[model samples]
Target: MPVERTENRGADELHRYYEVYETIGSGGFAKVKLGRHIATGEKVAIKIMNKKDLGDDLPRVKVEIEAMKNLSHQHVCRLYQVIETSTQIFMVLEYCPGGELFDYIIAKDRLSEEETRVFFRQIVSAMAYVHSQGYAHRDLKPENLLIDEDHNLKLIDFGLCAKPKGGLGYELMTCCGSPAYAAPELIQGKAYIGSEADVWSMGVLLFALLCGYLPFDDDNCMVLYRKIMRGNYDNPRWLSPGSILILNQMMQVDPKRRLSVRQLLDHPWVVKDYNSPVEWHSRQPLGHIDEDSITEMAVNMKRSRESTTALVKEWRYDHTTATYLLLLSKKQRGKPVRLHPEPAVCEDSCSPLDILHFSEDEDAVIVGSLDLSSEYIDDCPWISVTQQGFRGQPDGLTNNKNVVCEIWDGYGFCCVFCSKKDRDQEQTSENKENIVVQEKEVEIFALPLPRTPASSKKNARHNKNVLTTPNQNANAINSKPNAVTPKGKKNLLVIQQMIERLNQTMCFHRSRSLDMAGTGDSGKKKRGGKMFGSLERGLDKVITMLTPSKRRGLRDGPRKIKAQYNVTLTSQTNPDQVLNQILSILPEKNVDFTQKGYTLKCQTCGDFGKVTMAFELEVCMLQRPEVVGVRRQRLKGDAWVYKHLVEDILSTSSI
Candidate 1:
């Protein structure tokens, strides 16, 4: 899914290198374009980041460059260059061969078990390398994972990598990240380890993939948060045993317990040899993990909170924007609770005024009494993150419901959403026989609410940055800033080579002009001035978003990028039979195709052929949809059984 660059033609002395191509995409913060390097005659993806516009968070750009250089793997998105000037920062990266995986999943109705495995294995392998290097990919989701021509995954967007040990204990007061996939603890206004956060997201991604919807979902965010905090979502029977196993571990309410990348790699779902369907068969019905586990996580959230607090405090600077201490407080008198603290930059706890117990370990915070009927917590929350710090919760506790909640905890503030339920609360609690299930204690602990001290001396607001370690009468619990430059072996050349290949392809049939910004003599460039249409210029842009939108629907016929191509489904074809027939003829080089809906291929010859069931589908806990939402199938409260789909892959290949 290479970006299609329309030429931005210009003339200048610097134009000695490849010509400037057209813009692929643009947002307020940055713009990306496709270019052909004159020296190498190669096509490349170039992203320009505006320095002043990134607000005060300059390190993110640096983090991205640093991460790309140090981390390299086949499945990992390749980084090519980091060109920095006093005014700008230019990042050159290897283009992802395919478009956003988000769009991909939407189009395919999700991949088969084997397809999911191929994707997971590649991504986890990339993550394993990333984690082993002593860093955490604070942000992980479908959007960041790019696919190449071979359907290989490449993890991109390292703007939030946290050095596990070496980080200058700079307190990161400003919580920044996507909320939908944030871990439960994060939503609870607690400190979280970077690795722990990543794993939580992995669970969300997996759930969405398997179920074709978010696991714990709500249009109203508060409702969503409540669901997550409960940590009591349902896993559908349709999910494979292997997938269920990984989802169980990755989405653990507690970060410490959340499966590590390495651990996940070893799980039956991730490991290549394990048969998912078979394992699900012999297993007994899965049970709901003790609801207490979520509350337990609330207790363990100390690490993320304390650590992030210490990091922020340690990095206190005199800059006005960095100063300001806002304490989170709850209104004692309102049904619709709202919080208005000293207003400053921070991660505000997402909970409303309703009092509730939360277990720190699982990062699961359960709150009761939300008016979910009208307004849902899932729709919004009381607090939100602002550049200055945390603002009042986004949505007050307006919706009324009587269930616990889940949250996305950030540096200081948090966002909450409802989790997918085992069944609506009515069904779960209505049955007298299920009393034992309700009796299980949720391991929530009482925490000291941060409040303004009425009597304690008010520390004068100095440079608002609170050092992690204490002052002169001190120990080093904080990090100081000299702005250490992270050094790493650069992998920019690989990106350059790939780009060059694209440039050659673009030029193969068309003579396209180039462009430059701020240069005096501008050159005139017209669309399709070159012979090859979008197909040609697009190859030059590696990191492109490919969707049916661009191809004018499947009716546009099959489209090919580089050597990569997609075939169409026709009315005459028997979907299952076609898939099976296609897989059967593989030359033992390109496929280990499965009828259950996946295929493995030999790279050299593209011939690994049709596969037989190494495993069968066994629902560990198959329940009615009303019972389970989209949680992994393993913990479905006991009941699951077995099937093979490899034959379809063989048949499909021939079509």
Candidate 2:
């Protein structure tokens, strides 16, 4: 489907690069259309929002864009750029072909513990990164999480994101977010810290993921609020004791007591065995809400409604201007009603002592509650990356072969890169047909991971200045290895090239142990105090004894420092399928063991096999312990080249 071209020359001209297809998804006032990028032949999802329908939410739209533009996490939906016309705004976003997490949950009822843990870890990592940058995703739910073709999760919908002024952590006072996932502070309409509230929502999400239902759901709105406020919920028998412990801490009634993102990451249940230790950044203080921004939003809300006079009359100077602005915002979106008649003001005080009252029907539509009646797409087929190949065998090499790389192209799209050979042909067919090319021949390539989102103005300016083009992108592939300058932040093309070079650089060597070195004041104190050192050693031994896998794995010297890298496996292969392939080739005498960490470790025919069953990869690497070398197991006699994967993961021992 081509773009619905209009006479308004501005929009038509802007959309020329894209051939819009059928609406892939829709939201409150926006619709997401599948689009094809003419220049790159990349498939993208363009979210179009009409200026006329935005009403008072216009400021929010700007804020949402501002918030999303700066974020570049692998788990967060990428926003490429914004295109505005006289009447509509187009947000070019990454297209997630796997659809929503909610749909998967509905289909599976509940996920296995290992599967849930993989997704939960990713979400926690993303939240930790975003919180470190001083932004809060106020609305987090299953519906807001999209699964990419690789089954990797991407968080979307930043319409309720809160960024404090001065780039610090700030308390959000607004009664927003979905009721089912809302924290106690949000439900009670209290001013609460953003990250803490996020923790509560995550707890709710985890509970739902494990149990296939929300912990605090109720038909009556008031009953739900009461349940959330009291931290009232039952623990399902199926939930692991470790999981229950973490959830208990996250869903605390008091915001202050709730687990911070850092704590959540550090928790034993979250870390387990396979997940590497994350070095969390220092706490960034939240800034106070900008009065000017709040005031501008309030003004927009007033303009949105014609009869806000009665609503304004009920306001008293008792609350902060920010609070009043939020109240006005609620009036703009939901039911229309008049506030209670003016209360008699005490001569001694300027502020009123009583709270404003609403009429019976309108009272239910108060702060902290949003209408959960919106229609959402839950039937979209799982769009996997593994498609049928032309005939014979598919190209597996990085150079001079049939390669189809998925690019997140800022529009949440699974776009395929076009080789120079196909460029002319693609250009010729741009007008007559939609550029929905299923496959493109290209050199073997790795997509660059998105840059981390930063909140500082300096980072924002840097992002704005970078200009990327297909010609410049080609240079990344063809250019010889050199020390690239960071003067202009490295774009996706440059980063991808860097990874290709890295794959050629690494060689087999016994990685060294990086345990604590050179006795400092802390080390000296521990050594001098015999009882303290003994007590610590005793505790460590006790912990090891209790954990069977850790004890067994470490019995021989320290466990070999396993190499961890980031790679999105082809969509055609799932973990189970890959596991079966590896098992087929294993010797009959293979001493295979299945563990809680979704890992299969075996020793067979002089090969040490470590298979990780994850959404991203179906890794089955055989290590020859005698030579201290690693080799990937062949899948159906085809070389599964993983050399292009970037080694961004930190080793637990090193940290």
Candidate 3:
């Protein structure tokens, strides 16, 4: 009889089943390499894992194999068998002759249209299979997707997979995904719906596939979340409509609103427009995937992800399973590389809730809601520009007891306009006479370098100024008799926003007005400064005249008014007139209204860093007859809601 060779259970003696091939990878677990079976004469791949390699995860090897077995779509790699020994476990799996999807993206910068369609189809197929099997592949990023010798996909990593029965809409609060790829619901620390969360990940993948960049691209996180919620996308005009349609439907903001896998399969981008929809795969409306392999592929699945069972170690009891892994060194084992963490500011700081309101550089401000549908508060003392800067108290709008402003705070709205100006940062000149202020210049705050939106941006040159025009005709009937109900009235807030922007144009031409006030040595007197050219007093009289007597005193000198106004508006002329004219045409609200609807709050509370302020009043042009030239009034009516915005330190006085 011929001598028969028997396999041994020891670590060193078990190398007989195959000849080791070159190393493919060595990571946190163990080294994996290509090998050829000694008796079979065919190529095979081996993943060697030490008993310690499994750590707390040792028992889950069976669960991994179980999930891998269930994930058998054309896009998912298959796990074949397990071998064991006292020292290690060798997992034999289907090897992808090709590599990772991330490499392809970096190498080509982006996927071409045809390439995207093909890859997308494969991804949808994989998603459908896993979901149908009642499982969710939570981590579906490009790197987790691999290609085979024929460029087929192999989605691996079963650690985060879960079944959909009790698992499907369940919330995964584990802040576990990458920030750039994370969905808004995830970042908010809200409960995340399963497959829907996966869809958001898919949306990110699609965006990167097309633009070679992220859609929510921003360094400042608060700003980034605002942009994401805005969802105003500029598609590269170059893309085809079919792809756009699919992406539009898949990326719906509401989780329940997104497309299902089967619906996505029927998507025009997936199947041609001429093709009919794919049939439901299950019998309960969506017939089950009545495939022949279903029964044959079934395996015992009492495997819990957190199991303490030593399944893989038990499999290692056979000699052949314990081969070459025993010789691999620790250095040969390492974790796979991952993307670097995003910048700190890019993480939690940004969000939709932080937007205090939208600024149009006009008459009244929209207190909240980005679309400006929220309420508009008007009639507060808006800063007016004079030759010195602004009117009201000589210190301009800086005086806290008088001046007020609104800023965004995340939770609700906090009034920041109440803050005092930075006295340390103020300009110091002994001359102080003339209530010295800044010169007027056309400055555009919304240019590309400082890059602001075109709609919000104005040119540096003065655009056409809107002169005060009487809207007497429309106002007569529309004011009361024709007065519409709240529903019928033009959004007063909208009207106010327009007025606020238009007001920018009316800023006073400081030097020109000082000439009218008086040009002489009287301009220099200390007592003279307040008593200057004015037969009455210097800017002091102007301050008192503009101050709201019933309440707070004067703010900074009027020059402060000019600076704030200039900073807020692009061109003071036409934009101003346009805003006022629009407001004048607005239908008045009916006094019969009884109930208040709601209040809008600033959304980005986290972005407000601590701040300082400054104020100066600039007198400009000759006094106006119609207007009080410049006037200040205490907070009243709807505007009172925002009066808390200004800081306590600001009082009616020149700093």
Q: Report the error of model 3 at residue 324, Å.
A: 23
Q: Where is model 1 poorest over a 10-residue stretch in terms of lDDT?
A: 635-644
**Selected candidate, larger TM-score, 1 vs 2:** 2
Model 3 residue 300 distance off true place after TM-score fit, in angstroms = 27
How much does each candidate deviate from the true structure in C-alpha RMSD?
Answer: 30.4, 25.6, 31.0
Q: What order do candidates take by TM-score, descending?
A: 2, 1, 3
What tens-digit string does per-residue lDDT give for candidate 3 at 156-200?
767666664476666666555556566667667777776777787
Question: Candidate 2 versus the native: TM-score?
Answer: 0.44
Give candidate 2's error at residue 549 in angstroms: 70
lDDT of each structure?
A: 0.40, 0.48, 0.40
What TM-score does each of the candidates earn?
Answer: 0.41, 0.44, 0.39
Model 1 lDDT tens row, 419-464: 2231133123333221112243221111111122221122124112
lDDT of 3: 0.40
Candidate 1 residue-pair clash tally: 156
The per-residue C-alpha lDDT of model 1 at residue 40 equals 27
Q: Pick the candidate with the highest TM-score.
A: 2
Model 1, C-alpha of 615: deviation from truth (Å): 42
